[model samples]
Target: MSSSAGTSTQGEPLNATALNRQLKVMQDRINQLEAQLQAGSGAPRAKAGEGTPKERKRVKLSAPREFDGQQAALAGFLIQMQAYLHFYEDQFASEFEKVTYAGTRLVDKALTWFEPILKDYYENGDQATDFTKKVLNSYADFTEALSRVFGEKDEARRAQERLTHLRQTKMHFAATSTTTG
Candidate 1:
């Protein structure tokens, strides 16, 4: 009986330990490549004060400007909307994995219909409040339509409706509170 790791000489099976070790090596290499790709330049990060004066100056000059209340609020709303869209994307991806191709395609089509509104929001910074309101309203409508299509009450759909309602209530309160008090 021969115990060769790579090739089976006498019709023997390959060793599981050797196979797992090889897989581990491949996975390590894949991780390294992914790290390099994410780093953009594939270069190791330099220590502080190690880079050229020009590079250091560039980094120092890239500090973000301070935002006022309205701008900050708008930025927060944009970030929240983006997060919600990403959550929907993850949900659709999970659904695609579990369901048939046709079902996945239907979801893709629905997302396609909503894509333009997301793009518009991304492109325009002016009218941020109005755009956010529109986005929330549209998302609520989409969820309602989705619930109707699925023939079931969806918790996420209901949550979106509640969020929209709460936002409106908050806006109204703020407006009235400013005038009255």
Candidate 2:
């Protein structure tokens, strides 16, 4: 019986060593269980008919658009006026009739596009302001020339003077009228 007990004891380590080995085994088992639980929880989430993970389920914009119609009309008018001025050279006068027609068309379109803005300003009683002032001043010059051409004192002289005034002033009509109709 003593010989059998000794043989069994020889196969086993000391108490401390045995305890350490048991602890390591337990720790390894705990680590494996933790890994399995984590994996189970993180299993591929079922997507509800949505294509792939990379595909967005919904689109959202961060901000609203800001646009001012009056400002836009003012800018367009300036561009058209610049183009008209460039065509006033002597070389361009050879195509005067066509250029005039094009200028008229541009002005018409500008007026049409800007009419609503003008109407709003007039109705609001804020008409005689900024760009409107410049435009009316220019129109006054043009009408002055038109009146001269229809036979004012020294029709030729006055007409030439009006033309010269326009060339000097280089004005455009106001987008809005201060005086309400």
Candidate 3:
């Protein structure tokens, strides 16, 4: 038999360079399709702000402390929660997960307050109470609602009022507590 050149489907003989290029192209296409298939197979996707789980930093984390329903403590709780979430963001795959997590960190009066909100969200699904619906859709909404409920705005206002009305009392010089002649 005579030695034959590498003939492609179009009767064009593929040299070593051309054949290698075609193989590489086929391999790249297979990888691309495989990735799409994996992505479409109901796999959980990370939230926009959170990167994929595998990419998460595995650092020592100190979680936020439990928050009781105290207006003065709300700011510190939010800051701690934000820092903790930042470190372990990939652990949560959805907005609901994050909201639920924050709920789990509540204690005493705060937990009591959150129970109904959590229930409304879980039992009602997408049709939960307005605040619950907002929180379920976004972590920011949840924190904002939490702040409104347990924030120091009212306390600050009351303190402001007291400060505005502050004045030195007028004391009579003759009216002394000690015996005087």
- State which candidate has the highest TM-score: 3
Instruction: State the lDDT of candidate 3 residue by residue for 1-181, as single tens digits.
Output: 1133466667777788877877787799888878877888644556655885565544587778889998778889999998988777878898878888998899988888889988887798877878777876788998988887888668788999999998858964675487778
Error of 2 at 142 (Å): 6.1
lDDT of 1 by residue, 1-181 (tens): 2345454566667687766776687799999888887987765666788888555533222212221223224344334444544544544454322222212223243445444544555576454456333443454443334334343346689788888887343434334435555
Pairs of residues at least 3 apart in sequence or in different chains that clash in candidate 1: none
TM-score of each: 0.19, 0.17, 0.54
Residue-wise C-alpha lDDT for candidate 2, range 1-181, written one tens digit per residue? 1123223345643465565666687799888878877888643455676776345353432221211223334434434434544544332433323223332433343345435434544665455555433333353332233233222457589688888887545767769758877
Better of 1 and 3 by TM-score: 3
Per model, how many backbone clashes are there?
0, 1, 0
lDDT of each: 0.46, 0.44, 0.80
Candidate 1 Cα errors over 4 Å, as ranges: 1-107, 126-132, 137-139, 145-181
RMSD values for the candidates in order, in angstroms, are 23.0, 26.8, 13.6
For residue 27, what is the lDDT in candidate 1?
Answer: 90
